[model samples]
Target: MSAKRPVRRATPLRKPVAGTPAWVMPVAVVAGIAVLIAAFWVIHWYTTPLPPKPLSQDTTTVVVSMMTGLPASEFDAVGQGTANNLIKPVSGTKLLGSTGKPEVFYLGAEYCPFCAAERWPLIIALSRFGTFTGLQTTTSSSTDVYPNTMTFTFRKAQYTSQYIDFRAVETTDRDQNPLQTPSTSEQKLVSQYNIAGSIPFVDFANQYVFTGATYSPDTITGMSWQAVAGTLQQPDSTQAKAIIGSANLITAAVCKITGDQPATVCASATIQNLEKTLK
Candidate 1:
């Protein structure tokens, strides 16, 4: 009687769906391939962006030699061709530096095309007063305007000089990821001077400030490192005119901070003339 009272209830089985739709698998496969391809691109971007690749000795040699070796004639010839008015004064600013010397503070990112253009002259100008080591070569962000412009990155770089102190920061890599951090004081200068949040922000000891490219990135947009370096020696080349010209102008700004010292550079007829234009 107990057993009969405990009669088990039958469990109902759910009906199974019919054969899978033919389009489902193919669509899924295509979607999976798309995802893989996208992931590949994200992970395997073309240029080596981070931990910047050190410039080749040959490249460095050429860069140093060409940048440093340029006859003052080339600079005199270029004579601030297109850099006119690119650098402007930031008034009522305190001079920033260390060790009884004026500091040249530079802020830029590797992805910045304007910064890319500006670095050429900055380096050339700095090289005249000092020496740079650990310089790395890279291109601007491939997706940015005037994309893939061959240039140098200041990350992992060092500048030494008796005339002045050089401070540079590559705030981000080509991927737009943080790479270097500027000092709190440097950030203060940036905040004060860089209202536009632009790249290639250069402060010549807070006396003169340049906020953008002195010349167009297009000047060397399609050129390779070697091509850019080679063309720089050509006084008639547009690249030289823009880059070297800008260097001459920048050199003049630095001279003001240095009290027109190193008569070799500050005394040069071209630099002296450009210095007059700084104000």
Candidate 2:
């Protein structure tokens, strides 16, 4: 018989002591990695400010202002008075007006010759529908012709009484710097409405559009803002008449959109009436 080797007892392997220090290292590392991933996700969400979430209501305060145009405080009284006087009551059948979408106007710097001229009429027309809350009376933009261009704080701007909505968007601050990039929707609207990126381009619901006019006749001549402001004070003066005539043209267009309810002159006469006058 072959000699049998002594049998050795099998040692039972102890399960890794529950929660031992060695195991703790791997668990801590996994926990740390998970925390880092969560932090990265949170950082990404906040860093990129998302587009303005759509409000449930169709109405927007800033949107409507864009249609009428920017408000020029200096021309507040006469400009608005003229627009109010000219507005005609809309016919019952044609009462619907304004897309109710946000309106936006892109203007840059106080040095803009076009804005200098356009501001007067725009201010007047917009005031008819809403109260100008924070219009700056001094010129603020460096590139704008109105070095002391009157400023208006639109945050307080509102039109609680009027049926029409309005919006004004200054792409750049008074310093001629970008504020917010134009929205894709805004870009498309501007592209369709802006006449060659003309300063002071105006559009009312894609229905009425005016490039410039409503201030000094010398606007095309590139006169200073002070000079134009002087002309508007005397409505009957030659300078005022030239400016008013242009304003009347704008009135006609605005009236057409407001259903003539707000522009009497435009409603009373045929296109022939003002077309001849403008020339």
Candidate 3:
């Protein structure tokens, strides 16, 4: 019986091939997955269209020309269409200015639908104080609430004025990629006043702040840039009421910062009345 038990033997354990490393299969599988992912992204890149280039000189002129606000009566007619009192007083902060002038800080993103809607009034208001060059056109993220909302991009834009100084930081583009970076102070002001850290945020000389769109993006949905600019000229239009009305209030805010410097704008009956409502 002892001899029979001795004849039994255990099965041999399987070993990797003599020349191959044990880890090679797993490494190859991981590498294959990585290559597939890279290839997918590469394909996507080639398939997607790029954002449009900076606006042409003629188009810019037309758009800027259209930004000139509507009549005081027209503004009253479309008052606050989908827009509430967006601007608020940012207390406990020093006057935000630079180079001996008041500063208007803008923080938003290209893919933001609310920012898209807000830019209309914002640009309308700013045009009264300064000029913009190198403005580009883009649409909000197609997957967002207001998909393909055609609007302007401030990324390559430059604002110039004698009454006030302007600063804009487009944190991300339509693809949600990192864009312009804001200075520490610019970011701090946003953090302090805009606790929610919402975009389309604007700071007017530390006197007032806006955390959201002045109007709803739905108003301008499905509209083209040229079509929207066309609406600004029509005082009776819904777009005019929302955009021009909001622009009037913004103008009033800017007026307070500039001491009503540019009488042509601040002294307007519209802005004067709106200025009184400021906090």
Candidate 4:
């Protein structure tokens, strides 16, 4: 009679502990380092500040200096034909402002790359005849061609001149959102003269129409606000050749509409030469 010996439960097998492969530890370390690097990159991308959304105080000062101080002699040297391809002559009823002065109407959107480029010469040219207050710095649309092109915006700006009246319509913002709507008269002008239905259109007293930028925006691409403004001082620089050259032509156009008033400006040998070539 034998009492069956208590069956002993088989000992549970323990997890086999083989020596760790030399490659496994290095692989684990490398994988861990890669994860840390990825995390750091994501953090840096989200935290890094983008280019200043608006002009800083220092940048504004530079802009003011450049716009107000570009030498007339330098602009003359840049010469004509830079804007000839951009501006066209149109003879119709005269366009006058509220003050009975000839009006220079500019219709454009901040998002427009051409508008961005045109504004440089436009501001420099207008500054010759008058002063601008409340000018703000901005960039063109990030999604548009020539994205992020730097320039000034006239949204909160005002211009005063004894020679002529300047009117700017920043129809849309840098994001292509409507910033300033065009007036009924402005709309009519757009429909009438802007046959191309494009932005950055300029109607100089209804005597001349500028359909697009006078020069390639590429000239100033990747330039900082300060750099672009500073280039106006250097006549030999390509930026000056494009920006100041266009300005000279615009000055000539405005002089024609103003009856060549402010003789100091229109009488300049360079402007006079450009005036003769104006179509």
Which is better, 2 or 3, measured by lDDT?
3
Task: Assess candidate 2 and give its lDDT.
Answer: 0.46
Number of the top-ranking candidate, with lDDT as the measure: 4
Model 4 bad stretches (over 4 Å) = 1-51, 81-84
Q: On residues 118-163, what C-alpha lDDT tens digit does candidate 3 reach at each position?
A: 8888887888888888776778876677777778888888888998
Counted clashes in each candidate structure: 0, 48, 0, 0
CA RMSD (A), model 3: 6.5
lDDT of candidate 1 at residue 279, scale 0 to 100: 83
Q: Answer with 1 or 3, whichever has the higher lDDT.
A: 1
Off by over 4 Å in 1: 1-55
- How high is each candidate's TM-score? 0.79, 0.49, 0.76, 0.80
Off by over 4 Å in 3: 1-57, 69-82
Global fold similarity of model 4 (TM-score): 0.80
Say which candidate scores most in TM-score: 4
Residue pairs with clashing backbones, model 3: none
In order, the Cα lDDT scores of the candidates are 0.84, 0.46, 0.80, 0.85
Superior by lDDT: candidate 2 or candidate 4: 4
Clashing pairs in 1: none
RMSD to truth, every model: 9.1, 16.1, 6.5, 8.9
What lDDT is reached at residue 42 by model 4?
Answer: 94
Better of 3 and 4 by lDDT: 4
